[model samples]
Target: MRIILALLSGTLFGAGLVISGMADPGRVRAFLDLFGRWDPTLAFVMGGAIVPMAIAWTVQRRLESPLGDKAFSLPETRGIDTRLAVGAILFGIGWGLGGLCPGPAIASLSLSPVAVAPFVLAMFAGMGLHRLFTR
Candidate 1:
């Protein structure tokens, strides 16, 4: 089922994060602390991810349809605008400060990390506020 596969994917992703030393905030911060205890490994990690993503995206672009679907489900965005920019800015700031975005934070929390609670709480609160504003 899709749900089972989704869960498996999440588990795999979490394991990869742990194995890659990305779950540790110190390692991530050190990677970002260029010119001071700089570590370029994070760049390599990102690049590695990008390679697979790029290939998948390129392949997906040419696909006419999935096994069951009539056509590919895709979003049609008009253009990048203020809302997108502001949201990205907030996301970037949060990622920089916490060193754990949603996926990594949620995964790390499963390891009994006390640190992810606030970031997760704030993320939920922000989501609720956004829903309230949009509705």
Candidate 2:
């Protein structure tokens, strides 16, 4: 049941990314381009996502457990630190240069395999290296 819900959620998220033109690297890059030809479509999609997320957080606070889980395993981290700041900066740099973050990059794999496959491969490699160093 939990796996099914997780799969459904992922499918919906991927669909949203595709439908909103988020899976397009050019669209994402245009959104991030402040001084260039800026596109505000992604901002609207993000705003739409935030509404449901905020509601979910509120409901999560009142719930002891989720429908498919024994307990909510929310992150316990608080406050800014060097790790957080460095990670955010690195992520921003990557997004700026690559023009696609993980979600959109992954979603785009099928759409543009020749271009996106390398990004996805590099992403997984980075994740593996992070796990190795963190552990």
TM-score of each: 0.83, 0.93
Cα error, residue 118 of model 1, in Å, equals 1.7
Which number leads on lDDT? Answer: 2
Scored by Cα lDDT, where does model 1 land?
0.82
Worst 10 residues of 1 by lDDT: 65-74
The predictions' CA RMSDs to the true structure, in order, are: 2.3, 1.2
Evaluate all candidate structures by whole-model CA lDDT and list the values in order. 0.82, 0.91
Give me the displacement of residue 99 in model 1, in angstroms: 1.1
lDDT string, candidate 2, 23-101, tens digits: 9988889999889999999899989989899999999999989999999887897999998999999899989889889
> lDDT, candidate 2, residue 104?
86
For this target, which candidate reaches the highest TM-score against the unseen true structure? 2
Error of 1 at 79 (Å): 2.6
